[model samples]
Target: MKKYRKVSREFSKHTINALRYLVKKKIISQMLGVIAVGKESRIFLALSPNGEKLALKIYQIENPSFKQHVRYILGDYRFRKLGSTWWKIVTLWCSKEYRNMVRAYRAGIPIPKPIIFKENILVMEFIGENYTPAPLLKEKLPQNLEKAYDNIIKIIYNLYHKAELIHGDLSEYNILNFNEKLYVIDWSSAVNIYAPNARELLFRDIKNISIFFSKNGVKIKPVESVFREIVGESISQ
Candidate 1:
């Protein structure tokens, strides 16, 4: 087995064991390096035994805001009966992201294909080249902003109508722009359409995307109009 990077020591025992399990099962050969870090998780670049690049997202077991994550999981019927233990919650959150990605990918949404998840670690298709991650939409604005804007709107529509989910935390930061193609990421906070605050979350997602494209010189419909068009009801209604 290849030696892990120095940063590997930061992972929890469960995470380390999970990685070992994946290696033993030939799911991934080894982790290359950290690709990105967020408040509650870290994404690592990894390789499969067949030399395929993959993204490994490890949710922090000791994340201080685990309590806050309850809101997203609570209203989603699929996980309603899950336990409240912190580790279990983190694991559930990781599973939520993988399942959300699977739904989006199956719906033909531009997203990383979810391979599998174990404990709090999620392995998925990497969206970059040669161990370099794709630039985020915020980092590298596309030259054709108009087309990008349209693509995002269409993705939002499909996610709602076909996938039956709403990206609760959609923003440029979680979107990748690789070779002028857009792929949504960080789906841990996404919720089903039947969630209590689904409409509010969907509206916020639309508003965030609309504000971004409009400020970047792309003509965009009003946030309310876009929201209503997707949800089939006015925000006020």
Candidate 2:
């Protein structure tokens, strides 16, 4: 497999071996280059055996803040038992993201389609063209701020009422503006509606989006009003 740019060497040998396993399985043909990096993971642009573009999100095994993720996992009914080790925790976190993406995609949310996940790596549909990632919403705001604001609100509503999931972290940073289309990314922090902290997370998600749009002159409704419309109840109710 050919690697393009030099990525962080902090990746564990286990993650390197996992990449080899995927190649052997014919799941990915080549690793083009690093697409983006985040606090706990690195995203790489890759190609499938059929030459289709894919995004490989590899969670860092040695992430110092891996412990902070325990709250998201513990309240998730899907993950009843927490992992005993850091590697295990990161691996489960990767799997959780894959499952969350599947749920959101199936529910008609505009998210990258999750292909598969192995170990600490998650393979999904590439959201950009020609190995270049789409600009983030914060980087390039759409021309029609009103439409963009409405679209995001619909996504949040569907995430709650349809997918039964809460995007615990929803902000311009994690949202992509691809040719004026909005695609929400980063699902590891998403939690089910019944999660213990779901209400708080959902409120925060709505508030983040509302704050962003309002600041950009979208004339958004109050955060509580939007939250109540989605969940069918006031935040304090």
RMSD each, Å: 1.3, 1.8
Candidate 1 Cα misplacement greater than 4 A, ranges: 5-8
Per-candidate TM-score against the hidden true structure: 0.96, 0.95
What's model 2's TM-score? 0.95
- What TM-score does prediction 1 earn? 0.96
Error of 2 at 236 (Å): 1.1
Question: What Cα-based lDDT does every candidate model obtain?
Answer: 0.90, 0.90
- lDDT of candidate 2 over 1-237, digit per residue (tens): 545213424466888778878888999887877789999988988889999999999988988898888889876889987889888888999999999999999999999999999999999999987769999999999999999999999999989999999999999998999999999999999999999899999999989998898899889889999888988899898
Give a tens-digit lDDT track for model 1, residues 1-237. 545545568788899889888888899987888889999988998889998999999998988887887888887988876656888888888888889999999999999999999999999999998778999999999999999999999999999999999999999998999999999999989999999889889999998998899899888999888888898899888
Report the error of model 1 at residue 172, Å.
0.7
